[model samples]
Target: MNDEILVPLDLSDAIAMIDRQKEQIAALTTENERLRKEIKEIKEKIKLTNEYVDKYHGLGDRSLEDARKVEREIALSQSETQWLNR
Candidate 1:
């Protein structure tokens, strides 16, 4: 048999905890939005870079590698955003 002890929480303490949780949720929402915006900006930059590389260098090995790196970054950012949404 397992025994469990329940500790009583005061109303003020419960309210404080709720307030702290709200603050944390707000902070996380702000951070998530910021990250999403940053990811959009980065993706736009990557598109421009890809275009320039294609036009000027015809996607040389180094440029191709850089593009792959940007793609990975985008993938990771998207996954993070999805997780945040969940």
Candidate 2:
């Protein structure tokens, strides 16, 4: 089997290659801008979700505190009833 020798590219061919690379760079730049906008939108969504989570946890803490206060009151009332019975 005969092996093919590699030929050197001429100057015009190299310039044409550079022009193609420039076109690809322009296309990639446009794509990059689009991706950046998408990333910014995702970040905003994440921020809103974090704010909602914070609000939900804050309400849960208040609910838990109120429940504990009610439990204490019920215990006090039971103790008073027992004393009256005795």
Candidate 3:
């Protein structure tokens, strides 16, 4: 009768592959959270900028009316001065 021997398989390589996959998943999760925070901050900044622009639009109309009033007063003063000189 002849005898045969069987060798046992090693599982270290499989365990290393699983560890690498876990590391990749962790990295992806961290990157996703960072992107979400950045998006939120950008949206808030846009909202603030829009509000500032709207406020300035109202101020611009008031400034234009004031400038027109000043110009009329200057013109009337110049006309009176010329009449007095004559």
Candidate 4:
């Protein structure tokens, strides 16, 4: 049989415990808000990065003639049906 006796808290102790828990909850709420803001900022940064990459991909020094020549070379290497399928 268990011999330990359980002790109950007085009113003051219970009130103190409640106040401590309230402070903890408030701190957690603030942290949650901060994390949400950080996630939004990260998402924005990712969007900007994707835009920069898309813009960078379009930057080219090739002339129209070079592009046509490359296309002709690719056409020669692969069958017309394969390109059509794509």
Ranking under lDDT, best-scoring first? 1, 2, 3, 4
**Candidate 4 local lDDT, 1-86, one digit each (tens):** 13222223455678889999999999999989976875675566557555655555555654444455555654564465346535
TM-score of decoy 1: 0.55
Q: Write one digit per residue (lDDT tens) for candidate 2, span 1-86.
A: 12222223455678889999999999999989976875675566556545655555557877566555655665676577558646
TM-score of each: 0.55, 0.54, 0.50, 0.54
- Over 4 Å off, model 2: 1-9, 59-86
The number of the candidate with the highest lDDT is: 1
lDDT tens string, model 3, 1-86?
Answer: 12222221225556778899999999999888876775675566556545655555567877566555555655575577557646
Q: Count the clashes in each prediction.
A: 0, 0, 0, 0
List the pairs of residues colliding in candidate 4: none
Per-residue lDDT tens digits for candidate 1, residues 4-69, read: 222344556788899999999999999999888878877786787678567646657877777777
Candidate 1: the clashing residue pairs are none
lDDT over C-alpha atoms for residue 27 of model 1: 100
**Ranking 1 against 3 by TM-score, winner:** 1
lDDT of 1: 0.75
Q: In candidate 3, residue 68 scores what lDDT?
A: 55
